[model samples]
Target: MPSLVRAASIVAGAALLLLAPVARAAPAAGGYAALGDSYSSGVGAGGYLADSGDCKRSANAYPSLWHLAHAATEFAFAACSGATTAQVRDRQLSVLNAGTTLVTISVGGNDIGFSDAIETCVLGTDEDCTDAVAKATTYTRDRLPADLDATYAQIHHRAPNARLVVLGYPRLFELGGCFPGLSEAKRRVLDRAADFLADTTAGRAGANRAEFADVRGHFAGHGVCASDEWIHGVTLPLDESYHPTRTGHAKGYLPALTGVAP
Candidate 1:
C-alpha cells in the first residue's frame, strides 16, 4: 500500500511539472501592446526615450503609464509620433501577436492632414483656415472611414485575442484665452473638426469590436487656453506645439485609457 501511494504522488508531481511551462507560456492574464500616433507616442509629453528617436516616444505616454501601473503584463510600446493609419498598419502591427491581451491606439489625426489644418487655423487668414478645415471635414466624412476600418481589421488580424482601445483627438482650444495669434473663431472651427474626427473614430471602433476612449470631456477646461493648460500652445521647434504636456499624459490620457485600457 505504501509503495502504491508513493507512485501516485510521483505521477501528480510529474503532471504539475509538465503543466508549468504551458502556464508560463500562456499567461492567465496580462500582455499589453500600444500602437498609434503622437498622442499615444507622447510627442508633446516630452522626456522622449532615446531609442525611439524621431518617433518621439516618451516615458510619460499613456501606454508607458499603463505598463508602469500594471507591471505584470508583457508590454510593447510601438506607437510613434506623427503616425498615420497606413504607418500603423505597416510599421506598428508587427508588435502584436496572439498572446497580446490588451492593445491601445490613437491615430487618424495625421491621416487627415491634422498639422496642416492646425497651421492654417493658427497662421493663415480666416478664409484660408476655413477652406483647410472644410477640406479636412470632408476627408473625415469620406476618406477616414475606409482607412480606419482597414487599420482596425489589420489590428484584429494581428492580435485576435487582444482587447483593442481606440483613443480620439481632444479639442485643443477653449472658448476663452486663445493662443497669441490664433483667433477664437478659428479655434471653434478646429473644435468642430475635432468632434468630427472623434465621431468617425468612435464609429470604426464600434464596428471593430474595440472600445473608443473618448477624450472630449476628459480634456475639458485643460485645453491650450486654460490657466493650467494640459496641452502645449504653439511652442517652438514645431514638434512641441499643440501636443499634450506631461501632466496631460498623466492626468488626461492616462485616466482615459486606464478606464477602458484592458
Candidate 2:
C-alpha cells in the first residue's frame, strides 16, 4: 500500500510539471496608454478626477471606461484638454514605451482651427462660416496629414508593440433640432468639415498601420441638436461647447474603441 501511494504521487507531480509550460505560454494582460486632446480627456463630460487639474481627465471618459472593462498590467492616461498634435508629441509620448500593448489617440482637430470654425458658425455671418469651413477643409488637405504622420511616427517608435487606434471627431449638429437656431446650410458646412477630418485621420492611420475609430455616425441620433443630445451645445463655459457629454463617451466613443479588440 505504501509503494502504490508513492507511485501515484510521482505521477501527479509529473503531470503538473507538463502543464506548467502551457500556462506560461498563454497571452498576458494588456498594457494601455491613452493620449491626445480634450476629446480623449472628457472635457465636457464633467466630474473630473481630483488630481487631473486643467487636463480635465474625467472618470467617465471613454479611455477610463475602456480601462474599467479591461484590467491592464500598466495603465497611463496622458491625454489633456485643448491638446494639439504638437503638444501630444512633446508632452504625452514620454509615457509610452515598447511594452505598451494598447493605445488610443484623439487629435488633429485642434491643429486645423476647429474652435475657430465653430465660433464662426455660431457667431459670425453665413459667409464667414462658409469661409471658415472652406479654410479648414483646405488646411486638412494640405497640413493636417503631415502633422498626423509626425505624431504617429513618434508613437510608433516609442511603443513598437502597441496596437494604436486613432479616434476621429464627431459631427456636432443634426439636420433639425428643438433649438431651431443653427441653419441647415451651416450644419452642412460643419458636417463636411467633420467628414474631411475623419477622412484625413483615416488616411493617416492607414499610413501608420494603425486602426481608425471613424466616429462619424456613432453619434448619429444623439448629436447636439437631437432631442436627447449626446453632445453639448453652446454652453456658458466656452470650452464645454461642441464637446461630448458623458453619455456620448459611453455610447459613442467607448464602443468604437472596444471594436478594435484590445
Candidate 3:
C-alpha cells in the first residue's frame, strides 16, 4: 500500500508538469488579427480559408494556413475584398489589442488600382501601358511610404506587443517575353510596377521594425505572363484575374509565414 501511494504521487506530479505548458500556451489575449485586402484573403487561391461573404477570403490563404499549421488559439481575419490602407486603419486596426501576438498585412495594390491599369493598358497598345505604368509608378513611389508609416503606426498602437509582418506584393509580370498574351513592352511595364510596390513595402516595413516578406523573389519567373505562372494571367481562366492560384498562394505567401506562430 505504501509503495502504491508513492507511485501514484509520482504519476500525478509528472502529469502536472506535462500539462502546465499546454495550459499556459493558450491564445494570447486578443489573438492574431490579419488585415489587408483580396490578396491576403486568398481570393483566387482556393484553400487558405473558408470562402467568406465579405472578403471572399479563402481557407488556404497564408495567414489562415499559418494559423492552422501552428494550431493558433485565436484568429481574427478582417481582410476585406478590396481594402486599401485607409480601410485598414478605419475598419480593422481597432480589433487589435495588447494581447495580440501576431499580425500580418498586405495592402497598397488597390490604392492606385494597379490591377485595373494592367487590364486596361496592358491589353491595349504597348505605348499606352508604358505611359500608365510610369504614372502609376510615380504615384506609388511618392505616396506609398507615408501611407505605410501611418498603417504601421495604427497597427502598433492597437497591438503593441504583436509581431507585425507586412507582406510585399508578388511580381505580377515576367521580366522578359514570358507572357505571350501581353506584349513584351506591356510586360516590362507591369514588371516595373511590381518591383516598385515590393521595394516600397519592404522599405516601409524595415523603417517600422516590422518583418517585411519579400514575396516577389519567390516567384521570379511565375508572374502573369510566365508559362508556369503563379499569379493569374491577364486573361484568367475564370473571371477573377488579379489573384493567385493555390500553388501561387502556397509559394508566394507561405514562405513568408514560416514559424510565425503565437
Candidate 4:
C-alpha cells in the first residue's frame, strides 16, 4: 500500500509540474503572501508546489490552490509546519512589502498547543477530556487572540493596503454518533475547542480590519472521525492523523480565496 501511494504521488507530482506553467514572471506589483502553520501548509494534500525542502508545504495548500486558481501575479508562501502566531509575524511577515496586495493566515493552533490538547483529551476518558478542554479553552480565550492581534498589526504596518484574511481552524470533531471511539464527553471537549478557535480567529480578524474565513461550518460532519472525513483522526490508514486530505485542501482553498480576494 505504501509503495502504491508513493507511486501515485510521483505520478501526480509529474502531472502538476508539467501542467503548471511558470506563471508569467510575476509583475513588480504586489500580489499575495500566505502565512501560518501546518494547516495552511496543507501537509497531507497533494499537487501544487515544486517539491521544495519544506516537506510540509504541499501544493494543495490553500495558498497554492488559490494561487493556481487565480494565477496571482506574485505569491510569497512562507507558511511552514508547526508555525505559531509569533512565527507568522517574525518570520513570514518580513517577506511582505508595500506592493503586497493580499494576505491570508491560519495560525494560533500551535500557540496554545491545540493539537496536543486534542491528542490527549479526545482519546482519553470523558472526565479527563473535559478537564483538558477547560484548560485549553482558558488558554485559547486569553492568549490566542492577543497573538493573532500582534500578527495582524505587523501585517498592517508593513503592508497597509493589503487585504488580510484569517482562516479559522476547521472543526476537528463531529457531532454525536460520528466516531464511535470518541466518547460523548471527549467529543464535546473537541467541539468546544474548535468553536473557541473559530470565534477567536473571527474576533481577531474584525479587530484588525481584516476579513475572516469561517472554515468550521464548511468542514462540519467531515472532521476527525467521520466516515467520509477530510481531516485525519487518530486511527489506522492515516499515518499523519490530524491533517487534511488532498480533497480537504481543495475544498478549503476555494472559500479562503473568496474571503480574501477583492
Candidate 5:
C-alpha cells in the first residue's frame, strides 16, 4: 500500500499538473470547499456527520480528512449523494466565493446512470451488463463532455481565484479473485466503464485549466475482490455499494490529493 501511494505521488507530479493542452499550478490551499456527488461527499467511507443530514457526509470522507490535515481560513463541505453536475452547479456552488482558494469535486457519474448500469451488471445477464456499460461509454463520449464543460465553467466563474481539482473514481474490481461475485466478463466491462469515466474527466479538467487527481493507480491492488479490498461489495446501506471504504479515502484519496495539493 505504501508503495502504491508513493508510486502514485511520483506519477502525479507530472500527471496532476496537466490539463491535456495546458498545465496549471496547484491552488493556494485556503478557504477550501468540496463539492460533487457521493464520492466527494464520502458515502462509502462511513462515520456520517449529522449536520449534513440526508447528504451523509462522512467524518472519514476525503474532504473532512483534508480539512483536518490543513489549516484553511474556512471550510465548506457541500457535496451530496446522487448529485449530478447540474445539481452541483445549482446547489453546491454557493460555498464558493472570491476568497475560496481551493476546491475539489467528483461528479458526472450519476448523470450517466452509474448506479443503474451497475445494477444491470450485478443482477442481470452478461449481455445486459455489456449493453449497460456500452450505453454508459457512449453517453460519456457523446454527452458528458458538454455537461462537464458547462459545470466546470460555472465553478470557475463562481470562484475565480480558487484552484480547482477534479477527482476521478477508481476501478471497483480486481481482475481475478476467489470471490464468487460478478463474472470475469462483467468485471472487465465495469472496469472499462470506470476507465472511460476517468479519461473523460481528465480531458475536461485539463480543458478548464484545472488539475485532475487520478486515484486509479493509488487504489490499484486494493479494489473489490482483492486480498485487501478498499471498495465495498453488496454492503448494508446499499448506497455505499461499489464505493471506496475509509481506507480508500485515507490511503488512496489522501495520497492522491497530497500528490497534487499545494
Candidate 6:
C-alpha cells in the first residue's frame, strides 16, 4: 500500500509539472552596426583586435561590449581611428542597411578638430591652447551642424529601420586634479569645447530624429583630473592620450548607450 501510494504521488506531481505555464520567448536580437571614430572603436580601452590594426578597435569598446551583451545575430564594427565625418560617411556606411536594426556613432569630434585642439593645448602655450580651442569652437558652432546633417541623413537613409543612436564626447578633465599637468585655464577651455561638441551633436541627433546618448553625465567626476579617472592624461603612444580608459567605456559609454539604445 505504501509503495502504491508513493507511485501515485509521483505521477500526480509529474502531471502538475507538465501542466505548468511556459515562459514567453525573448525578443529577437537585432542586427547592430557600430560606426564612427576611435571613441566608438575603443582606442584607449585596450585589448585591440589585431586585424583592426591602426584602427585599434578594442574588445572593450562600448559597441563590442554592447554586441556581447545582446548577442546579436549580426554585428559590423566599422569604426576606425582618426575617422572624420566624411570618412565615416565614405568608409563605414557600407555596413548599414535596412536589415540593420541598431546603429551607434561617435563622430564630429574629429571634424571639429578635437585631437588637434587637445594636442595644441597640452603641448603648446596658453595662447596656443586658446587659439586652437577658438578655431574648433567656431567650426563646431557654425559649420558642424551642416556636416552632421549630411552624415545623419546618410545613416538614416542607409538603415531606415535601425534605431540610430549618436554618442557624444565627454569632458576630459576635472578642475583642480590635473593642476600641474594642465593649467586650470587650459582644462577649462577643453571642457567647454567638449560641452559645445555635445550640444552640437545632440542638436543634430534631434534634427535627424535619432537618439543622442549623452556620456558627459556618466563621465562626470571621472575625467583625467579625478581620483577615479576614466580618461587618460597625456599617456604614452600618443594616440591613447585623452581617450577614455577601459572603465570609461564600461561604466561611462556603455551605460550611456544602454540608456538611449534600449
The residue pairs in collision within model 1 are none
Summed over model 6, clashes come to 0
Q: Mind giving the per-residue lDDT tens digits that candidate 3 earns over 25-51?
A: 112358777788878777677643343
The order by descending lDDT is: 6, 5, 2, 1, 3, 4
Worst 10 residues of 5 by lDDT: 16-25
Q: What are the lDDT figures for the candidates, one per model?
A: 0.77, 0.78, 0.70, 0.69, 0.80, 0.81
> Across residues 1-262, which tens digit of lDDT does each residue of candidate 2 receive?
2256543443333222101110001122338888888898888898888777777788999988998888645678888876778888887887787788888999987788866676666655678889988998999999999999999999999889999999998888888644444677888899889988999999999999899997777898888678888987755344566789999999999988887754
Q: Write out the backbone clash pairs for model 4.
A: 30-99, 48-59, 49-59
Q: State every prediction's TM-score relative to the real structure.
A: 0.87, 0.86, 0.82, 0.82, 0.87, 0.86
TM-score of 4: 0.82
Give per-residue CA lDDT, model 4, range 1-262, as digits (tens): 1256644443343222111111111123468887777777776675535644353567778778788877846887777766777766666677678999888888877777665565555345677777767777888888778888888999899888888888887877676675335666677777888788789789889998998888876787778667788876543323245667777777755565575573
Model 5 bad stretches (over 4 Å): 1-30
Best candidate, lDDT: 6
Show how many residue pairs clash in every candidate, following the order shown.
Answer: 0, 0, 11, 3, 1, 0
Between prediction 3 and prediction 5, the one with superior TM-score is: 5
Q: lDDT, candidate 5, residue 24? A: 15
**Model 1 spans with C-alpha error above 4 angstroms:** 1-30
Evaluated at residue 22, the lDDT of candidate 5 is: 11
Model 1, poorest ten-residue lDDT window? 17-26
lDDT of 5 by residue, 218-259 (tens): 999998889999987666555577778999999998888878
Give model 1's TM-score versus the native structure. 0.87
lDDT of 2 at 90: 81
